[model samples]
Target: MTLPDPADQADNPVGGVRTTSTVSAPTARAAWSITFLVMILQTVNFADKAVLGIVARPLSEDLGLSNADIGLLGSVFYVLFVITGLAGGFIADRVRIVWVLLGMALLWSLVQIPVLLVGTFTALIISRVLLGAAEGPAGALNNVAVFGWFPKSKRGLPSAVVTSGTSLSKILVAPALTVIVAAYGWKAAFWTLMIVGLVWAAVWLVVGKDGPYSVNSARERAKAGSAGKVERVGFLRIAALPTFWGGVLGMFALYGMVAVILTWLPSYFEQGLGLSRVNSGLLFALPSVTGMASMLLVSFLTDRLVGRGMTVRISRGMVSVVALFVCGGMLAALPLVDSAWLAVFLVVAGYGVGVASYPLMNVTVAHVSPERQVASTLGVFTALFSTSGILAPWLTGRLVDAATTPAEGYTTAFQIFGVVAIIGAVVMALTVNPERDRARIAAIDPLACADSSADDKY
Candidate 1:
């Protein structure tokens, strides 16, 4: 259970796993338990990130902030999230992922707990910055941890399930956090997340192993010598890949929509639809719950389908397009709806679509990129896309400012999101590399229809 001391990634390529301790026995049950633990940590990870958004009003009022200022909170997290994401990937490529996750989980949990003390905007912002910093390592290491544990074909479902951490966190946080705020004031939300985070850290220690090597992965990697043989690349070479930029643009838009919705949903419901804070929180949690289900369904189908020979373009990209279409439909219908609750339902449905896109797009990015640089490339990808965190929230806030009512904001913001998703679908459609993507899937799973013998006919 020894951890890698933080070090330069270049000195030891496999993050110096040679220093890692003994391997444990592998079993279907242990893998499932490990997978569940990953999901729990992920839940804490996202719950902390999302609490500010879920309880936006009370916190903002206590700190004397405006919509524009609230939006910037996302910026702090995204900035750190992006920067850390870059470094995390590199570290993941070089480091012992389990230990990296173990350390990050502990730090990030402590960071989220401090929001209880901040009454001033400056203090709140500083608190957010600290939380963001902790999140950086958590986000990066989590990806590496996932990659280290699961095979490529099997990775999609487990990854998506783990990724459902965000959705599940929102599900719990939106409703429960809203209630906590109503009962105990804004500070309770932060304290609550802090408690949950610390608990998750303890759980990880008890259940989490160092890597696949500690249990089953060691035997599997030994069987496939190529597992540990990936080469590390310099930043400049990684920067030059078109696929890198493509990932950036795609992820940017993806995260942009996600960030905007996270930051704006409560405000939109309260101000636009005129729902009470408690009601809005409860309603908001609904989509996220639905999103969790959709995510698992999409990821499971993705792995099985791709394993059966579906193209990445068709599998990942097309599945993502489903979210865009639904989101668009929800937006387009917003203005026409008379019932406030109905409109809320529509928007929540759109969020469901947003949930579906998360893991599929990530897996797509991983598939196209070289494995050695997956973390670095992913880091840059998250950073650039998360850069949208800076822009989308501001623009959406402006849209909120201009709207005559919460309903109007809901209608307008959603329409804009719909158009954005449509454009994304078009771009994704043009980039369908089914054959190449098929090869990528095949590389991860021997049974995936990646054989040259079948290539010519397809």
Candidate 2:
């Protein structure tokens, strides 16, 4: 149950740089335990997101709100998302990540109380804004935490596993929350989530600690003169790379579709497709189930490819290109289909295939970034792409409002997402050269590319 000592490991190469090696079997089990915990953490984080969408219809009805108003409510959550994601990244880099995660979880629970107590539009806005801010860094931090337990070559699967937590939330918790909303009403769903967040926070507080591969652990090694320090580079240097921006752009498009799904997919199923609330909720979860399977498959293949000596351009970059392209094509075809079943298939296959790019893009960025700047780089990356959260939902709302029919509006929105995904795929194809970017980083700051083993000592 105890974490393995990094001092027991030998030198290892990670992402083209020498670093501390892998843990023993028992240590790896402990690491995997941490990974599983963070995966659950991600589950809770996404459950918070999916709840608003599950209750969107009922809440809008209760508030007597228009489509535009509902969309604005969804958009408001991300008003503070980008800013907090950036700030949280810097904070995580400086502070103990365990503490940062703890603080965020506690805040998530507190934010829900606003909606529970007031049940007003203004109160809902307040809750969404606060919750968005708290959860903004969750994605980046979750990746960083899980990465701390694994070496570069083995990171893809864990990253996918962590990101799949969102899929898990949609597939499992969303349906359950839908029932809760059905039985107890929208405010009751908020109350339930608040309790869930609190319970998770309590568990995390007891079990959470930095992994052996964490910056905190590295700093301890440096203090003991057992590890050589990797010089920290300015954020700008890391940001300037094409790999960074390309990955960001790809993720931006993908996450935009994700935002639309989380905020509007259930509504689409209910209103656009003419499904019952329960059925809509179930259908709402279908894409995520496919998405989860796709991500795991892609990650497993990607890790295997990397392990087999394939270049990242082929393993990570090309995989993203293919997935995004498939997603785009499926989405574009959605409006063209006549049957509801066909439309559902397009959605499931499109979104499911498209989301696999998320883990690959994350690993690509992490691979190219200076180890010391990974947190900040990831923070900035998350912040930039997350702007889509603000735009996608609001824009979809406006589009739907402008359309003559609900189905027309929803299909138009899906088409736009399709186009964006295609563009992202092209960009990723052109720019996601992890080996080249790694070399570029090393050339810019040689010390940053030095062996990480000095920092790897537990």
Candidate 3:
């Protein structure tokens, strides 16, 4: 048997329905509905990943886990995270994304149950592995689904809203889960996460469905009457793009910085700074709240600028470049402060400004790739960045273990990654010229620029 070309399938609907138009109220409503659901699920997803970090101390003491063991536990999740994400990207393009999301949510909830029941390092390891596999594709695919709802120029704010869930979960989930862990045990926190996952799955089943505009760039172009034929560009060509390379390095730096903060922040406060658990939790929420506000503001500004006919390089790329530099500066100062409160403030500011670039990174890749290829492009993007997830936990663990004090180890880690982030910012500023890249992408395949001339109703 032979498989169908995704490019062809994107252009030619099987049911002969006209679903790719911007002039419909019903479609707009559905798009918003799906975007809202994506936000909720994404929040829950981050919450699930975060629970382990929140409980890391207690779990380590309870299970008698060494620093290396904890590092292995964190690293184990990414063992499958990268491979599944690559496959998930392809599956997302070829299959119904609704079912993909549903299945992943279901599996994630089920896997968490085993850890709560067994409550051992082995069981916890197993749970993390399975959950990682389930979540690997989620980030990329959810963005793909969200992007399907809006036209190219209108994607920034919606994408920011989705990405903001990561920060929002820290705000909402952190304090609550911390209390749950304090009152009950780390096991109870796992149970709460499981329940949240199940609830999100139920809501998704009732309301989730793919958007009509889920077709690729070629089909979108045909709809706009800008092109007469569809084209399929290879991954090699996309890989050669400067925008791609810049996104690769910049996203890796950004994700690594965020991952370090998320996985180690609580530990840093409790173990390094001698804060109470509740105080640590409350402090952890600060950066996320700041991040939530910053992301929304930056994304909205980028969208408004784009709508006003600003080139994406100036509107989105430069904004991210500036934010990255700010993030690096803050991280570099985090360990330099004499006061604990000042240190917290610096770290929070770092996380806040660093994440301001998240949504723009998604938009940057979308701007330079075809619509059909966006998910795969983002999947590869997420997978590459996700290595930070592996490295942050394990490397921080090792550095701390090797140090004379936890504070010194953490200080070293922060300074090193801070420098790396500034370098990434430099690369982004130098390499990503979105105006030139967009035109180059259009030359490679005109469909990538579909409806660019369409009046901005959004």
Measured with C-alpha atoms, the lDDT of residue 72 in candidate 3 is 73
Considering every candidate listed, which one attains the maximal TM-score?
A: 2
User: Each candidate's lDDT (Cα)?
Assistant: 0.64, 0.82, 0.77
Best by lDDT: 2
Model 3 over residues 79-188: C-alpha lDDT tens digits? 78877887887777657778888988898889887797888787888898998898998888888888876667778999988988888788999889999999998899
Q: How good is model 3 by TM-score?
A: 0.90
Worst 10 residues of 2 by lDDT: 8-17
Question: How do the candidates rank by TM-score, highest first?
Answer: 2, 3, 1
Kindly list the per-residue Cα lDDT of model 2 for residues 340-449, writing each as its tens digit.
Answer: 87888899889999999888888888878765567778888999999998988888889989999988999999999999989998998988888887888777765564
List ranges where model 1 is wrong by over 4 Å: 1-25, 137-140, 213-230, 233-244, 432-458
Q: After superposition, how far is residue 137 of candidate 2 from its true place, in Å?
A: 0.6
Model 2 regions lying over 4 Å from their true place: 1-26, 222-230, 453-458
What C-alpha lDDT, on a 0 to 100 scale, does residue 117 get in candidate 2? 81
TM-scores, in order shown? 0.82, 0.93, 0.90
lDDT of 2 at 133: 90
